[model samples]
Target: MDKSYLDNLKFPASFFEDEVREGFLVTSMMKRYWASQLKVLSFVVQICDKYNLKWYAEYGTLLGTVRHGGYIPWDDDFDICMMRDDWNRFFEVAKKELPESFQVLTLSNNEEYEELIGRVVNCNVIDFGPEHMEKYYGCPYTVGIDLFPLDGIYPDEDKEKDRVARTRKVLKALTLAELADVNNHELYLLLKEIEKENKVVLPLNDKLKNKLRLLAERLYSECDVTECGNVALMPFYIPNNDHIFPRKLYEDIVELPFENVYLNVNARYDELLDLEYGDFLRVNKSGGVHEYPVYSGQESILAEHIGRNPYRYTLDANELLRSVQRYIMRMTRTVDKDTLPNAESMAGGSCADSGAVIKKKAVFLPCKAKWWKTMEPLWKKYMDDPGYEVHVLSIFYYDSDYNGNIGERHDERALFPEYVQVEDCEKFDFETIHPEVIVTQVPYDGFSTFMTVHEFFYSGNLQHFTDELIYIPYFEADAPIEKGDKAWTALSVMVEQEAVVNADKVIVSSDAMRSFYVDKMIELCGDETRMYWEQKVESFEKSAETEDDSGRINNEDDKSDMNAWNQFLGKYAGRKTIIYYITIAFLLRDTGKSIGKIRRALDTFSDSGDKVCAIIVPQEQILNDLANIDEALWKQFTDLVEKIKTTDNCIYDEKGFSLGYMDKWSGYYGDASPLVRKCVQAGIPVMIENIDI
Candidate 1:
C-alpha cells in the first residue's frame, strides 16, 4: 500500500455545504416518510373494505387526500377520522382483527405498551410489510401512527362545520398538551385527590376522566357560538349526541381506488380536495433519499460542510495512518531487529492500505482526491496474494471546473459495491445484494446516528447483504458543530427549569417544532412518561411562568419568595398570554362578582387559604366612579366578600390610581383597540374599585 492516495484524499464540500440543501433533505425525508404513510392509508382502505367500516381522511390527512391526491409528501405520517360510533367499532375489530404485524394504537392504550405513546405515537408507523418487521425487531418501542375519531355534535346548518373544525383543533391541542406533560403521574394523582373530595365533581377521574376530557375538550374545540351555547348548559353530561358528520356534509360514502386497494372516501371529496390541493392525485417522481447539500462559501468550506452535513468525513487518511503507525515503527524499530521492516511491518502497512484495514481502523471514510494518491496498488496486491476482499465507498457530487469557477462536473465514478443507497438502508430486509464485505461512505461523528441501522444490516435479518460487516463512520464524530454538546446543554437547561415535569413545559412555537421537541424528550425519558390531562396544565404553567405561585403571603418562607414572584405576575399583566384567556378572565372576574360565582369558577385558587387577591385599578376616575355606587348594592357586595373570606389574601392593589399609557395592542378577537388597551391598563384583573353594581 502507498500513502499517495491517502495523502491525496481531501474532504469534499459538494455533498454537504448548504443549509438550504440540507433543509431540503429534511423536507425530502418527510416525503420518504410519507411513502410509508401512504402504505398505511392503503391498508386502512382495505380494513374499511373488509370489515365494512366507514372512515374519512379527516383533518390534515383528509386535506392531503383531497388536495394532493395522496398523503401529503411534506407530512411524516397519515391520519383517518371516523365517527365516534365507527371509531369504537373499528377499535373493537382492530384489537382482534388487525394483522399481527399491525394494530390500532391509541393514547388510552399507552399503559399496556409503554412504547406506543409519546413521540413513538408521533413518529411514522405504517409497516412496509413483513420484510420491514425487523425494523421494530427488538426495538422495545412503538413508532408513530395516525387515527382520529370524529365525535358527535349538535346539528346546525350554519354552525356544524365550524364546530367540527374547532373540535379538531382542540383535540389536537389536547393531544399535544397531554403528550408533553412531564409530571403526568403527579397530575393524575392530584386529579384523583380532587375528585375524591367533592361530589359536585368535574370529570378528572380514570374511566370517566377520559370521557369527560373528550367532552370538555370538545366544548373547548367548538368554534360556532350557536353550537357552544346549545351544549354550554346541557343538563347532565352528553357524549356526542349528534352525529360525527352532519348529513349535509356527508350524505353518502363512496369507494375509491388507491394503489390497488379500495378506500372509502367522503362523497363530496372532489370539491373540497380541489379547493385545498389542485395536484391531489399524482404519485411521487422518485423514491429514495434525496441529497440536498448546502452551498459552502469557499472561504469556510470545512465549517460550512459541517453545518450542512449530519456526518463528517476523514480526508487526511495517510496522515492519520502515519500518526498511528509512527509510534508503532518508532517503538518496534530496534537495533536487535533487522531494521528491514519485516512481514509484520508489511502486514501492518498492507493493513493500512487495505479496505478491511481501513474499515476496521479508520475513524471516518477517506474523501475522494484529485492530485495525490494512496498506496492502493500495493495494498491490492497484498490482499490479492493473501485472499482478502477490498471494497471502498466514495461520494460523487457536482464540483467546479478546473478554472476554479463554480460549474457542474459530470464525472461518473464507480461507487464501492458496499455503498448502499440510503433508501435501501431504511428497511431491515437487506439480503438481496450479497457480498463478502461492505463499506460505508459516511463520516465518523455521524456513525452513531446510523449505527442501529448498520447493526441491523450486518448481524440481524440483513445478514444476507454481507457475509462479514466492516464498519467505518461516514465522517469523524468530532465534527466542529458540537451537536452533542448542544443537546447536553439543552438537557441541562431543562433540568434546571424542571421542564421535564410535563411535555408542554418545553414550549415550542409551532406544531412541527413541537413534534421535534416531543420526539427528543421521549427519547430522553423513555416509556414511563405517558400523556395525561392534569399534567398538561402543570407543564404549560412552567413554560408560561405568568403567575407567581410562591407569592402567597402564607408561610414565612413564602414571604422571601413573594417579592420577585409578585413582580413577575405584574410583568405578566403587560405581556401577551397564550394560556386560556377565557379561563383567566372568568377566574379574575370572581374577585368583583358574587362569592358563589368565584367559588364555582376557580375552586382550586379560591380555596387556597393563604393567597392575596388584588383588583388593580389604575385610574382615579374609575375609583371615584366606584365611590358613587349605590349604598345598598355596596353593602350586599361587602357581605358577600365577608362570607368568601380567606386569610393571607386581600383585594387592594397598593400601586393605587396611578396609570401608565398603553400603546396599541392586539386583543384575543384579533382586533386592535385602544379602548380595549385602556380597559386592560385601568381595569384589568378587575375594576372592583369602580364596579358600582
Candidate 2:
C-alpha cells in the first residue's frame, strides 16, 4: 500500500473528471464522494500499516480493483476485510491513532448502528441533490469505508459446521435483538425462529443484546487462525464450501491502484473474484446495492461542512462528534406517546388531545344481530369488568344484488343482551365516544361481498374513530380450501379485506384457519411478509368465540336467542330432536332438493308423532334475503319453513345459530355444506342423513 504521501495524499485532477459512462452522467457529487471515501481509506491504511495489521479489498472493492481502476462507476461504498485477529488488532490501533477527522464506528462505539460490518468514516458529512433541487440534507450521512472480519474454519468438519451455523445465528441474534421493542410481534416471532434454528433461546430483556454480542465475540474469535487452512466471513458464510474461500488469499497481499493511490489487494485477487462472482470479467453495473451519494441522514450538521471549499470556519471535532452522538441518542431513544413528534395530533389528524375518560368504552359493532354470538363473549368480559363501558352499536347494513340494487335494510338490534347498553348507530357519535376498543363481526369492506355496511359505519373507516379496531369473523370456515378452489378468489378477498387488514387485531376461529389465512397471505405477498401476518392473526380458543354448527351457542348467549332455544327445549322434554341443517348452499346448488329434504326429513321424523319433534335450522343468512335470494327456488321452501309454527312437534328458532346441537341432538341432517363440517367437528353422535336429490 502507498505510504510515501501519508501526510499529504494528493487529490488527482483526473479523479475529479466527470464523464457519462454506461448511459448516465457521473455527477461531481459522486466524484467528491469517491474522494472523501479514498481519504478515509488512506487514514485506515496508515493505521493498519503502523500496527502491522492486514486488510484486503473485498466485495465491490475487490471487484473494482480487478475490473475498474477505482470504484465501479456507479458504486457508492467501499469495502475491505481482515482476518479476525488482524481485524481485532486494527480496531485497537485505529481507535487510539486515527485523527479527529476520521471516526472508527462499530456496534461497540455507536449504539444505534445495527450493521454487521465496522466503518471508518469522515467526521464530515456529504450532501447530494437533484441537479435541479436543493436545501435538503440528511443527518448522520457521511462517506465511510466498511470493515468485515474473516474468521478461520475449524479443522473438524462437524466443528466447522457448528461454528459457521452458530456464528450466522449469533449475527442474526444481534440484528433480531435490535428489532425487538414495545410492539410484541414481528421481531418476537423471529426470536422463536432463532431458538428453532439453533436451539438458542434469546430472551427479550434489557441485556439480550449484550448477551448475544458476547456470544458472537466468543464464537468467532475462539478458533485458532494458524491451525486452520480455510477461512470464511461468517455473516455471508454457511455450513458449506460454496461461501468459504482459500485462507492463502489474504496470507500474501499485493497493491493495486484505486483512484489516485494504491490500496492493498489479496495476492489471489483473480481467483478470489472468480470464486465470489462466477464470471468476474462480466461488466454488469446492475448489481450496485445502494442509492448514489447515499445520505447519512445527518443533514443539519452536513449543511455547515459541505460548502467547506473556502474554509469559512474551523470545526471543534470533539463537540461535532458529541452533537452526532446526541442526535443519534435522540433518534434511537424510546419515546413516550406525549413526546413523539406530532404525537399530540396522532388521533385522526386532530390537534386536540382526546381527554381521559372515566370509563373507556369497548364498542361491539354488529351489522346484524345474528353476528353477535362471535362478539358476545368479549362484550360480557368487558361488561362484567368495571374498567370498561360496553355498548352494542347495532350498525345498519344492506343486502344488495351488488349492481347497486339494495335488497333489504338490516338494522336488527332486537336480540342483543338487554342488560348491556345498546347504542343508536345514528345518534351515538363515534367521534365523541372515542371508544378504546371496537370489535366488529363483519370484515367485508363492501367490495369483497354482497353485504355492505352503512357507509358511515364501514369497518374500514372505523379505524379512525378508535385506538384499537378488532375484527372477529362473523362466520366460520368449516374446513380450509385449496388455493385454486373456485371460492378462493372471494375467500382471499375476505382474508385481505380492509376491515381485516386495517384492524389492529384479527381474531380467527381456529389455528387451522389462522394457518390457512397465513399460507394464503404468503401466496399473495410472498414469504417476506409472513411474520407480519403471523402477528396480525390470532386464534381464539375461548374468548370472542363463535357458535358451533348446530346453530347452538356453546356458552355464549344472545338473551333473546337463548330464550328461544330454551323455550323450544321446554316443549320437547321427552321427544327425540332432529336438527335439519339448512345452508344457502343447499338452496343454490340442489335444484330445490334442500327445500324437499327439509320437508321429507321433517315429515319422516314427524311420523313418530309423540316420540319425535323436528327442528328446521336454516342458516342465519337465509333469514334476510330468502324471499328474493332466488325468485325461482324461494317458492319451494317458503311454505315448508313456516310449518315449524303450524305443526306442534316441529320447532322454529328465531336465532337458531345462538344454540349448540349438543348431547341432546338425536339426528343431524344437512346437505354437503359447511354445516356438515361443523357437525363432524362437534363430535356429537347424531345420526347423519344425506338425502338423494
Candidate 3:
C-alpha cells in the first residue's frame, strides 16, 4: 500500500495569517483539523466511488458547500447522510475496505454513541477523562464526518404518524437507557410515556441498548426508500416531522468540491437550502452547531497538539516540507508510533461492537412477563454465557376466533425486566431466525385454551423451525397446579400435549412433578417408552418457596412509576376500591341494561357508608371520540358517567390512567375481558359483571 498520500499532507503557514472566511478567524489549528478530516472524507469518497454508493452533504455541510466551497469557518466535523440501503451496503464493505486503524462507528459498533448514525473514523481517542467520555462520546466536538441514515417516509397520514411515533418511542427508550440528561423536561416526560408503552428494555445494560438500537433500525427499515415519495431523517430524538422532504430533491446528485476532492450534494441545493433555511446564501455567523475550535471548555486542544508535534505539524510550512523531503530520503519518521492523531485516516478505510459480533443461541417465549419466571433460571444460565443469546420474543395469544388475547392483555412489555432483549410476535421471523433451541412455557398447543399461538408459532409448528424444542410447563414450573382430579385432568391434557410429546427436552419445577410427568407419559404410551419419557422429563429441582423470585408482573410500577401511580390513586383512598370496568362490547351491542348495572354498582357503593369506593373505568375511547352522534341510549350512558363523577363514594377514571393504580384495587367487577385477566394477573379478586349499554 502506498503511504505517500498521507505523507505530504501539511497545514500551510498562511493559515496563521489574519484571514477569515465567514468573519470568523481561520486559525492554523482549525485548518489542520480540517485537513485531517478532509483526508478521512477523501478515503470515504474513495470507498463510495468504488462501490457506486450515494451520500449527500447535509446540515451544516450543505450550507458550507454552497457558501464556502468546503467547511464553514465555525463548523467542526462535516455532516452527510445516505439512504439507509446505501448505508447498509457501506457497512458490508467498510469492515474490510477500511485501513487498519480506520473504523466506521454506529450504535452497532460504538456503545459510546446513542444516535442512529455512522462515523468513518481513524485512530483517535480523545482523553477527556472518564466522565466526559461517558457523556459526550469523548467531548462535544465531532470527531469525524457524521453519517446519518435517511430512511423511507410514509405518506399516508396514519402510517406516517405511526412510523414517526414508533421511532420517537424507541428514541425515548434509548434516552432512558442512557439517562444522559435526566433533567430535560421534554425528555423526562417522553421517557415516562415510552416506558409506560413497553418496559422490556428496562434494567438496561450494554446488551439491551444494542437490542434497542437494532429494534429501531428494524422499524426505520419498514418502508422502502425507492417506492416512497419522501425520505425521513432516521433519528427521531426530537418531536417533529419537519425533517421529512420530497424524494425528488435528492434524485439528482452533484459531486461538488469540498476541499481537495469532490463530495456529494443534491443538485437542487438552491431549493433545498431555501426550504430548510430561508436566505441560505447570507452568512450566519452565530448558528454553528458546535463551538468553533474547542469542545465545551475554552481550552484549545488542537493548538496544543500543533505545539506538541512540532516535527511535522509546524506552522512553518517551508520547514515542514523540508523535513518531509529529508525524512522520505532517510526512510524513517520521528513521530511516535502510538500517539493518538486527530482521527487521521491512512488508507481505503465499543464494548467491542456488540451489535455485529454477537449472535443468540435461542429465542424464548414467556407469553407474558409473569411466565418469564418459569424459565428464568435456565434463561440466566444461557444469557450469562458468552456464546449463547436469549431473545424474549413475547408472543401474544388470542382465542380460536381471534376475539380475546389470552395473555399480554395490555402492554406487558412494560412489566418485563430491563436487560432482556424482548420483541413482539409481529416481528418474529421463524424462517429467518431459525433458532437452534426454542424454550417455550406454553404446552397445551391448540387444544386446551380455545386460545393458541398463531399456527406459525404453535409448538408443533415451532418444532420444525428449531433444532430442539424444550417445553417447561408454565403452571408447574412457576407455581403448583390445581389439586386432585383437576390436577390429574390438567395433566392428562398437558402430558399428551404435542409440545410435551414432541419436545427434545421437557423440564419441570420439581423432581416429584417430573416423576408424575414421566410416569403419566409412560402410562399413556403403553409403558414401553418409560426410559424415553424419564430422560425427556427433567427437573430444575426448584424449591417450592422460590428464592429471589421476580416481582415485576404483579407490580408493574413498583418504584419507577410510584409518583405517577400514587398521584392517580390519591382521590379514591381510605376505602376498599372496586373497579367497574366497561368494555367495548357495548359498541357492538348496547341493550341499555348494562348502563343500569353501572348505576346500581355506583349507588350500592354510595349507600355502603363510604366504606367501599367504586371506580367506573371505560376501555372504550368514546369519551374523546364521540362527535355528531345523537343516539338517545348513548345519551343516557353519558349522563350516568356524569352522575358517577359527582356521586359520593365513586370516581370516574379516565382511559389513560395507569393499570398499576387499577391493579391496587381490592376487587374487580367487570366483563370477562383483557382487563379482568390483567386484574387476575395482579392477584386481585374479580367478579365478571357486564355493563351492556
Candidate 4:
C-alpha cells in the first residue's frame, strides 16, 4: 500500500479508538463462539453440499483458519460467502434438501424474506431463538449467521470504487414489509429491495421518509429490474494466492492450528488477510487494537457499514432513535381580511377579495330559539340595529314535517319569537329572502385575516357586505350530524360552486377550531396564503361573471339604469316549472338492473337520435364507474351527444315535499356568474325545478 493510503487509513481516537472498539470486541467474540459451533457449521456444510452450493468461509471465519489455524481466540462469529448465482440456486434447492432442524436461511426461501439474502448477519444458534448481548453491554442484541452475496462487479474500476464509497444511503428508510409468508425477518426484505440498483435514490427529508417509502414502492413497481448489471465479488485480490506464501504456493486449502481447534485455509487466505490487517499471520493473537470491540477478519469492514445504515443490512435494526421539535412564536395573530392583494399574480386574476360588493337592507330579528343562543353574540355585533330589517324566513323545528308546498301554517313565535335586532346587520328582499352575507362558526383559529382576504379579493370589489358574511369556525362541539348536515352541505355546495370561494375567511367562533384549520390548511396547501386566496378568487370571479348579463346590456348606462339583479328577479320571480329528468342515482343505485334495460334508457333519453342528454351525477366516483361501463352500454348512453348537457343540478332540503315553492327556489348553487353565463351562452335554460305553486 502507498504511504498516502496508510495515512488515510489512520484511525481517529474519537470514532475508531472508542466507538468502534466495543463493536469489534462483541463481533469477534461472537465469531469465536460461532467457529466453536462445529455442530452449526457441520449442519450448514451439509446443506451446502447437498444443494451443491459453491460457498466459501468468509471474513473472520476465513481469517481464523489462515492466521490462527481456526477461529481467533477472541472472535465470536462466523460468516460464509457465495457467488450470486450459486447463492440463488442454493436458496431454491436447500428448502427441501436441508435437514428440518436447519432450514435454508436465504431470502429466496420465501418471497416475503427475499431481503435476507443480501444482508450480513450473525447466524443464531437455531436451538435458542435470539440472544441478548446487551446484558453484557447496555444495548439489545440478537444472533444470526452472517452471510454476504458476491455480486457481479461493474467492469469499470471507477464505477466499482464509486459503488463501494456510497454508504448507508437508504439506512433511515427501513420499514416493516408486509409479507405473505414468514421465511425471514421483514427488515431483510426492506434491505433487499433497496440494494437493487434501480431502487436507489436520494433520500427525502426525514419527516417525509415514511410516506416516501410507500411512494418509492409504487414507483419501483414501474421500473424494470433486469437492467441491473452483475458486478464481480472480491475484485482487488487473486483468489488462489495467499500473499504471505507467494503466488508459487497458491492453494484452495491449507492446514493451520487454532486456540483449541484445527482448521483449513483457502489458497488466497494470506492475500485477503493482508488487505484487512496489513500484516497477515503476524498477529499471533486475535484482539482489537482500538478501544472498541474487535471484529474478526475483514468482517469489521462490513459491520461498520451495516451499523450506520441498517437498511443496507440484510435485516432491520430492532430499535432506532428519533428527535422532534416544535415551536409557536406568537398567539392570537389576526390578519386584516381586506388587505390581501388580488389574484393577478402571473394568472392575470386578482385574489377573491377584490371588487366584492354586498348590498344590505333592513332585516328583522327573529326570536332566538334555544339552539341559537350560541349565535346571539355574533347577531348582536353584526345585526342588532333598529334600521336593520331582519326578515324572518320561516323557522321550523327540526321535527316539523315541512311539506313541499309553502302552506300558511307558519308559527310566528317559532319563526321569530325574539325581536332583538343587531345594531349593524340588516335584511333585504324578503321576496327573494336576499342573503347578502352568510354567517357560520368555523372550527379553527388563526385564519381571520386569511378568511377575510380570501372572501372578496377576487372580484376587485371588496364592499361592506363582505364583513356581513361572518364565520365562527369554533362553536360548541357538535356531532357532524348535529352540526346540521344541511348547513355544512350548503357550505360545501357554496365552496364547490364558488358561491363563497374563501369560506375560511369567515371568522370561526372557537379559537381551538381556528387553530386546527390554520394547521390543517397550512399542511394541505403548503403555501396557505396563496392557495387559499387563489382558489377563492378563481371561484368568486367565475360566479360573479356568470351572474352578470353583460352581453344583453348594449350600453353601460343602460345596464346601470336598472340593477341586473332586479331584472333577473323580475324575469324569473315566481315562475314555477316542472323539471322531469333522469337522476344520477340511476347509475349508482340501479345495481339490480340488466344491461339491456340500461341500454334502452340510454338510447331513448340519454342519447336519443336527435340530441344526447344524460343526467350527471354529483359524485365523481359514480361518474368514473359510468365511464368504465361495457362499451355497448356506453355507446347507447353516448348516442345523443349533442342534446346532452353534462351540467348537474344542486338540491338541498329535499326531505320536505317542497319541490318548488315560491318562498323556496332551487337553482344552481355554484359560482353564479360562471354557472349563469354558461347556461345563458349555451341556451341551456337555468330554471328552478318545481311544480307551479
Cα lDDT listed for each candidate: 0.33, 0.62, 0.61, 0.33
Q: Tens-digit lDDT track for model 3 on 1-693?
A: 111232243333333222234323443334545655766666777788799999898987887766565676656767788888998888778868877657678777677666677888654554434443332222313446778888887668788677668777876667666665445566556645655654444333346566667767777777889979988776642266567777877875655545444556775565567667776655544454444443323234544754532211112334323423433433332244355442224422232343355555688887756667778877876787887777778877543311223542334676677756678767878788888778987665654323456666667577777766788876532221423322333244355566676567888877767877877766656566676667667888654344455545435456646666546657655668788776433432334465677678777888888577777787543453232232565577678778987888877887646454764678988643345545554678877664432
Give the distance in Å from residue 615's predicted Cα in candidate 3 to where it truly belongs.
80
Cα lDDT of model 4 by residue, 94-192, tens digit: 546544444345333333343333332233231122232211111112233555555443446675444443222232233332322223345445445
**CA RMSD (A), model 3:** 31.9
The window of 10 residues in a row where model 2 has the poorest summed lDDT is 131-140
User: Could you tell me how far off, in angstroms, the CA of residue 551 lies in candidate 3 after the best superposition?
Assistant: 81
Candidate 2 lDDT score at position 349: 51
lDDT of 1 by residue, 149-173 (tens): 5444455645655544444433343
**Pairwise TM-score winner, candidates 1 and 2:** 2
What are the per-model C-alpha RMSD values against the true structure? 25.9, 29.0, 31.9, 32.1
Model 3 scores a C-alpha lDDT of 0.61
Clashing pairs in 3: 98-349, 99-349, 199-414, 202-418, 203-418, 360-389, 361-389, 594-692
TM-score-based ranking, best first? 2, 3, 1, 4
Least well predicted 10-residue stretch by lDDT in candidate 3? 308-317
lDDT of 2 by residue, 410-522 (tens): 77776554544677878778898788888887665555213567776666578778877788877644323455432333245356555665566788767877877777766
Every model's TM-score:
0.30, 0.39, 0.38, 0.25
